[model samples]
Target: MKNAPTATNSQSTKNNQLEQSQYNTESLTDLSTAAQRARVLHYLQNHRALTTLEARHLLNVMHPAARVMELRDHGYKIITNWRQDSDSAGRLHRVAEYVLMAGGDA
Candidate 1:
């Protein structure tokens, strides 16, 4: 009976690992806050809009709202709009979609 519990725990641990691996958090942590800000700004400048999911997956930014806040503090004009997006598990989540209205002094 104890062996069955151990097997279940092992499988649970593996599932947790798999979920963490899907996000690639290691690469996100490798980027400095300034670098992450720069990437977010550049992407916004070209694309004009960025979603939280896009920032995480494409720009490797873990906390995009933090980066956007930093940019706003630097005088950048950014606006946040909420939208419903589906996650990998197909659950709907209200995510922030940021739009850059103007550039600030660097």
Candidate 2:
């Protein structure tokens, strides 16, 4: 038999995640474009990887690529990898996944 998680375990997990998110929000001042750009970089720095859809869903930004361009302009070497994937409906599309390089001189 497979081990299953109980309801109490799930609630505690959600509470912990909520507390972590609250702490993360304290540093965000406003929802300006520059702030959004910083958030994108911060996420890339912390998570080390991000996709266009993830940025759109999480940061509420329409153009994550533009934010990536701004980061690059500021001397952040972000690498973009194009991936072909199929959506839930079976429609295929190309997506850009970004990663911040360790040494961002280029």
**Candidate number of the best TM-score:** 1
In candidate 2, the residue pairs with backbone N, CA or C atoms under 3 Å apart (3 or more residues apart, or in different chains) clash, namely none
> Residue 92, candidate 2: how far off, in angstroms?
3.5
For residues 1-106, what per-residue lDDT tens digits would candidate 1 score against the true structure? 0222355466555434333443453344658666677778778878999999889888989899998986675557899999998877888889999998854323
Locate the minimum summed-lDDT window of 10 residues in model 2: 14-23
lDDT measured at residue 20 in model 1 versus the true structure, 0 to 100: 46
Looking at candidate 1, the ten consecutive residues that score lowest on lDDT are: 1-10
C-alpha TM-score for every candidate: 0.66, 0.63
Tens digit of per-residue lDDT, candidate 2, span 7-95: 65654553344334434653445465566676787688788888887787676667899878866755678999999766557777798
TM-score of 2: 0.63
Off by over 4 Å in 1: 1-30, 102-106
